[model samples]
Target: MTKRTNYSKEFKEYVTKLVVLDGRRIVDISEELDIPYDTLQKWVASYKTKQKEAEDNRQNALLSASEYKDLYEDERRRKLELEEEVAILKKAMHIFTLEKN
Candidate 1:
């Protein structure tokens, strides 16, 4: 049986980034890094999956933030409208009371 070599997590992450993010070919990276082709392929796949998950989470958070902003803006507009209406009603009441005096 061949001796199993243990690679550090940092080394694995670097190799994965080279393959997935840098758009390097698996065979080329494997040969250049002196790593096995199958191992490099697996690392690339894992990195891509993690990257996709992170992007999805970021998009979801942005959507939730946008929704909250929309709700806040709507409430702000409604409050302003109500304040204007109350001002108008108060002016009308003053006019009626002045007329009654």
Candidate 2:
């Protein structure tokens, strides 16, 4: 009967990071760490999934922020246009009143 080896979570995470962040190959890491190739492959896949999720979340947040900024700038421009229109209307009213007097 083959003995089952239990690896710690920290150890697994460290190996996964080496593959994911350090751009090392799974086969090389597995051979270096004396772990099974399939096991290390699975760990790398899981780490990649988590990294993709984090990247997607960050992109979504940045998109939302950009959209909010665009809306704010649009509203500010509209407010300035309205203020200019109001000033023009006030000047026309003043001209008409002076003509009538």
Whole-model lDDT values for every prediction: 0.88, 0.89
- Displacement of the residue 51 alpha carbon in candidate 1, Å: 0.4
Give every collision pair in model 1.
none
Candidate 2 residue spans exceeding 4 A from truth: 64-66, 70-101
Q: Write the per-residue lDDT of candidate 2 for residues 1-101, one digit (tens) a residue.
A: 85678999999999999988899998899899889899899888888898899999998777577798999999999999999999999999998889553
Which tens-of-lDDT digit does each residue in 1-101 have in candidate 1? 96678999999999898877788898998899789889888888888898899999998777577798999999999999999999999999998889554
Residue pair clashes in candidate 2: none
TM-score of every prediction relative to native: 0.65, 0.60
After the best TM-score superposition of candidate 2, give how far the Cα of residue 91 lies from its true spot, in angstroms. 23
How many clashes in each candidate? Answer: 0, 0
